[model samples]
Target chain A: MNGTEARTIAAPDLLEMCAAHMRAGGRMQMAYVWFPQAGATPEIRYLASQGANQPFALWCCRPQPGEALPSLAKISPLLGWYEREITELGGVHFDGHPEPFPLVLHEGARSTLPPLDPRYPADQPVEFEAAPWRIPELGGKDVQLLPFGPVRADVLESAQFLFFYIGEGIIHYYPRLFFKHRGMERRFQGLCPKLGTVLAERVSGVGSVAHALAYCQALEAAASCQIPERARWLRVLLAELERLYNHLHYLGYLCHTTTLKVGEAEGRLLEERAKQLNAKLTGSRLLRGIIEPGGLRRDLDSAGLSDALEALRREFADYTARLERTDSHLDRLISTGVLTRKVAVDQGATGPIERASGLDRDLRRDHPYAAYAELPMTVALREAGDACARMQVRIAEIETSFALMQRVLLLLPAGPVRTDCHPIAASEGLGWSESPRGSLYYAVHLDQNGKLARVKIKSPSFSNWRAFPFTVHDSNMMDYAINEASFGLTTAGCDR
Target chain B: MPLWTFFGLTRGTATTAWPASGADNGQTGVLGMPRHYPDRCQDDCDACAAACLPGAIRVHTEASAGARLDVDYGRCVACQLCTEVCPAGAFAPSTDWAFGVRARTDLVWAAATQTAPARALSGMIRSTFGRSLHVRHVDSGSCNGCESELQALNNPFYNLHRLGIFFTPSPRFADLLLVTGPVTYAMRAALVETYQAMPEPRWVMASGTCAVSGGVAEGGYACAAGLEGILPVDVYLPGCPPNPAALIEALLLLLGRAPQRIEGGRLAD
Candidate 1:
């Protein structure tokens, strides 16, 4: 595949077009396909339906060879993965696809090809062969293969990374996940909207509010439900607080990883104080129960407002003082784990990772949702793109969030916390939010009965995971932990 | 000394001794819930039951009389949603935060019972000298919030280790297995395995709503019913995820120390 010519193929031109786009300096992002239900199709009928509210159309084609694959350029580069996914799951082959293999399921599983329809024999067990995965065996070279954990010494819910090292310097790192894959997505097949948000909340613990907000937004948009102004503002407040605490904790982790005691202590202090304030205001330390389907479950009173603001102001002041005294911590972070500005842009990194690389792209700023448009948001940027740069971006974000919280508190409108939300008769909508990890997008399709026909969540960790393989190249393996901590990628978000 | 140093010395002494005095006076810091109110109870409202995440609040409405709401202190996460959302302001958080008990039945508070007042001697003895506790955490497949807060205990504010409480890595060394999340099907085996590994003096503390009663994952094929189905949970900390202070109080209670309690509209002290 050359750069100049766009390759044309008879079988699924959409897949070929995606390959051509990637060959021509465009990166193949994400791709997945869904099938709509006509209520009669039986072969592949068990596949989930793309509800009415999703952004893209679910086009079904016969299992014949030679169809004009739609051009990939029409959709965002991130949609590339979706295309490959559709081919593998639906057996709709994309001719000239760079990597044509099964994605979600194991390889060589079933004998009879499942129809792309959603009404087929829903329980046919298919025999499939596992796909080949390369673990990069370093062998007898100076680079030793080290395996870390499917378990950690700490009580947190995550796996560890084994670092292959040469003396004090690390050569390679292997991250063992799947310790927390409880198959949440598989359970969403037949659930209604009211019950779906509960599942979304448990996807990742800390980002519960963000996930719930994104899921609700998708449902709301698909249903074309108008959220009250107060609900929107409260959502923004909760989201900013969520982002603030997460970023603060990330900074603390980064400092701790670098062995900077003072910085670690300060970071820990800020996090504790932030959580305390969050509980004082919203009642949940992690801000869980505050978010309900249509709007907030409860309202924040005047006393709550004053107490939260006062606590935030004091913490912010203390943070600034501590920052001045932690030069040694900053020294270790500045130039380590450098993901150059060019690489960050080409890879389409999002959130603080992109901001640190000097790419000034923020979902709040670019696609302003909720109260973010009302206030002036200072998107922090750093040219280094290293672990240190990432830390700086998080610190700046915390500062920015503190300012935003104050603004929201001052401008808070007097109104009811929620509006009466009714079941959607029939609708579909797209919902996206800038989670602490990055941009989180959800496409929701509602059945005629107002139940969730299908839901597709694109979490930031999916895209950021690509950057990890690239970031670790030619870098010492020991820095992998620091690099990963700086990124704060959630496996649950990605696996979902 | 510099001005900052002088201030630090003065402030450190003041702040360090505050927790000790506050604990003695039946105040559990800023995070602690206020004392519960009996007079303000309304016949119509069961606000605490509705707000409870773990369904720890049991409300019975009488046809001839007013409704009664019973809160199982063991099952309460101390999210304070019940206190905050209560319209009549009848519900108050117990300033006596420490309430770890030997039996799950003891944590259950009956709204109908106007029983003999809780023993005052327990609060006094517990406040004078803190107790030692050993915690073993089991992930029933959670989002890690409870674990994170538990980890934060090593920090300055909570300083759990200073109270003779240590978080052991292995179940063999554990006195209590602190479980979080609804026991998912995938984690059910692992939960049982961890429980079996623990020594005999072991107690299970179900931390989140998920752990106590399968939380949001309740009724799903992936989730087991709750911790009790596999192992008997002695204490229940009810929140989607409980606050760090609430957890500390629960731990203190387990070590034979009762947090300061109020009786008949008066502080226990």
Candidate 2:
């Protein structure tokens, strides 16, 4: 899995090569379909990365029209979602795929050709007529079905949960998310690299900096444009700020789910303070409108950045220390919605979820991007594989993020924050970032006019959401909401 | 529990006294929507229009006169790209975060014609739900930026409940339907159903630039251009994702508890 360049293998050897990579401890990072040229036959590509500090192994195969390709889901169950996604969007058939229903396209949704297929007429509109999804039947007198939402309570995103539970215990759990899909990846098409940052930042509001950084890096990689040193350090600063706010928000939301109202209030207040810091440092609270392809959109005035981080750090330590002392919060998190290490790896979990499950991997450390290689970071690991472990992972990561931000600010260089990124036509590149939720990757393909031809987003939430359902089955309904909160998933990330 | 209570008390009044005169709205030095000066704009220059991706700025050619740039704040994401690209110093970045208005037409601006003043809500509607308002938020196709600001409204800083506005779980109990995103087709049914479920005198507020005029993902294969022709909207607040204080101002303006500061798509100084 250490091959740096993408190799075009025949369709027959795709499964064998992937299996070998899997046997060598390589995990499938992402797979997608793209048209190599205008009206060209679609090619399905697979990307896999070996353990720490190794280059990704990329393999692609173009199947003749109507040719059924071998399913890699058998070798790695994590590929099930990607395979099904390719089947629906790329209009490819996977031979011997188990349980091949529509992954993204809902029932009664109509589109000419698959939406991701380049041949699909962009001008023609796709209609999503509301129709009932096929829910797997469960037999038993006590087993009843409950469809929770496409619209839920509170300020949560749109996602529906189909629960088949008997009494308090659950028989099965199925989540039908992606109600918030805005065709974000497609929106990148024909956009200049400058405007692309705006759309990438909006991919997931909380992961704004991470997505934008990854997108810009991909664009930079394509053109081999070397951004300024100050821009790299600033990217790290912005990234850490994003992680700080997201983790704090996650902790606060988790507190609400556990009925820790005071803890929730304290956490949110701290989150608000952190956001205010972001606003004071950068004009935008979410740190948007500052990242473009070559570098930052503007130079930041980080005069009081270290002071703000120190103050936030002190308050956060006190808050988390109090939470640890409270037994009620711990009781709800312990042993609730346990996702075993084996299941986590088998289902290809990433970020804190994987680290909490004892799969020690951080893209910042393993495959360093931005200024991460220069900074000292401790990848937090836990063996519990439960909600408590997840919370602990986030708490530890927040601490590391604070330290990293301080280091980045101290070593900040003086130079221009941006450079001219002249796009190289017909070039493709891969870029990644270790976001608060997990590792996020953006693959960009540039057109003749230096605009985006095709852009594929491998968001962390997409991977985590695929692995989330494993913990829900056979678990009681009581801990469902808390489990969900601990995962800290966003429907926009998945749906996009 | 006692420790938490004492700890909370010691933090000492984190709430801001906004909606009152000279209060800190918590958005000091933050960039808001782009402010346009028709006089400063060059007649042939369309740099801002070309830079705006959401099609918020468009140059319209009229047979009777010169080309006029139609500026729609409803579609503006406030990315400030307009200001960055404008050569004639026409589009200036301003801190006018409070851009909420009662009518959709109030969001569109043109240099040729003067716009009418924004109208306040009807007396009956305002008086009916003046003291308190229950809101049901729907995410038709948002990227969750709007939801983040919505969540921030409950923080101790903003404390939206103090203003008699609450986010309810049920549309049946909702007086106002606060909608976000560009109204994607897949969510069209659920959004409409929620609107139908609400009782009479129910109003819809399109928060964020996406809900106002589809933001950057406008006219895509999957979504409609905001809530324009889908449902009748009462309030239109535009931002890439409006900050928390802006949400409070919009909600308050909707309830007739606060005055509409935007007239003819221009912020009142």
Q: What is the C-alpha lDDT of each candidate?
A: 0.60, 0.87
lDDT of 2 by residue, B173-197 (tens): 9999999999888888899999999
lDDT of 1 by residue, B28-138 (tens): 233333345646877667766666644556676444344365555544545556776677777765544434433444445533433333344335435543465567787
Superposed model 1: Cα runs more than 4 Å off: A1-11, A17-136, A141-143, A186-192, A302-325, A341-348, B1-131, B170-174, B184-203, B218-221, B226-234, B259-269
Candidate 1 lDDT, A241-349, residue by residue in tens: 8998788788777767777655565666667777766766765567765676677767875356656666766765665455545666566666677777766645557
Q: Fnat per model, in the order given?
A: 0.25, 0.72
Runs of candidate 2 with Cα error greater than 4 angstroms are: A1-3, B63-67, B112-122
* iRMS, all models: 6.2, 1.1
User: How do the predictions measure up, each by TM-score?
Assistant: 0.74, 0.98
Candidate 1 residue-wise lDDT at A379: 90
Q: How many Å off is the CA of A442 in candidate 1?
A: 2.1
Residue A8, candidate 2: alpha-carbon lDDT: 89
Worst 10 residues of 2 chain B by lDDT: B111-120
